[model samples]
Target: MSNIIEKNVDLLKKANVYFDGRVTSRNYTDKDGVVKSLGVMLPGEYTFNTKAPESMEILGGKVEVLILSGLDNNWETYGAGETFEVPGNSSFEIKVLELADYCCTYLS
Candidate 1:
């Protein structure tokens, strides 16, 4: 069996609060067997467009965003701390209004 490890932001030596900055993360896998990450924009707006794998799912988040998925015609606005699940073989584009933070997690 594979050993499970849990990392807390409070206990991490590299974790620090950002007041007004933007941070982009590379792709990473989470403990829940999900590919999870975030693109943080402090006090400024940002946009992201990507093609997620078929099995990808948007678990939850807290930020205002416009979601344009291949499966949907109109854009979906996700409120603060919202959750979404993605279908297989789909693509999406996201746009954020104002300064916002978002969390993305994918399952394999």
Candidate 2:
């Protein structure tokens, strides 16, 4: 991923708050027409639903996750500079091991 992004962004206010406000995000579209979002997750367990295939890169801290149809009930850990993918029409449970900062790409 590039180290830079657009300066201006649209905030998703009044919605997209999850885990009782423990997670929050702001989304933006790039010049190439790809959609992405920056999000922060406080220390908590959270579940996220996806409308499209999503790729998330951890920018800070760490997370352990159990994806829908995850292998052998396995839970995977990811940290800064690591990435994970979730298929569209699925859900994943994430345990925030630390204050995690992430950027996600929404892929159609």
Candidate 3:
């Protein structure tokens, strides 16, 4: 609770629960009912399986991602303040260039 504040209703710590301890996140819902997660990733390559459309924003550092349904040629690079979208029922691969910080929204 110390690291949380008002309306920051969800907090998910990296306690080896998901992604084999590779990722950690804090979930919250805004006033408009938009659900989002603020998360961090260590320097590494990661693949995420998606069941719903997702919008991702990079908060710090950079990453190269391969979204099978979107990008054509090769992995695309995204840096701080950059964003991208991935479709539902698909998968995306991400390579973190640094300690990547990000926010992700699941769209219905």
Clashing pairs in 2: none
Which lDDT tens digits does candidate 1 get at residues 1-108? 022233532222343333334644344555454555554545344444345532322223334443445544665666445555554345444544444455555545
Per residue, candidate 3 scores C-alpha lDDT tens digits across 1-108 of 112334635544433234765687777775567777888898889888889899998988889999977547478899987899998999999999888888888899
Residue-pair clashes per candidate: 4, 0, 0
- After superposition on all C-alphas, the RMSD of every candidate to the true structure, in Å, is 7.2, 2.3, 4.4
Error (Å) of candidate 3 at residue 95 is 0.4
List TM-scores for all candidates, in order. Answer: 0.48, 0.85, 0.80
* Residues 5-47, model 2: lDDT tens digits: 5655554544456767799887777667688888899999988
lDDT of prediction 3: 0.79
Ranking by lDDT: 2, 3, 1
- Which of the predicted structures, 2 or 3, would earn the higher TM-score when compared with the native? 2
Task: Locate the minimum summed-lDDT window of 10 residues in model 2.
Answer: 7-16
Model 1 residue 51 distance off true place after TM-score fit, in angstroms: 5.1
Q: Model 3, 70: alpha-carbon shift in Å?
A: 5.6
Query: Model 2: runs farther than 4 Å from truth?
Result: 4-15, 70-73
What value does the lDDT take at residue 100 in candidate 1?
48
**Better TM-score candidate (1, 3):** 3
Q: Against the true structure, whose lDDT is highest?
A: 2
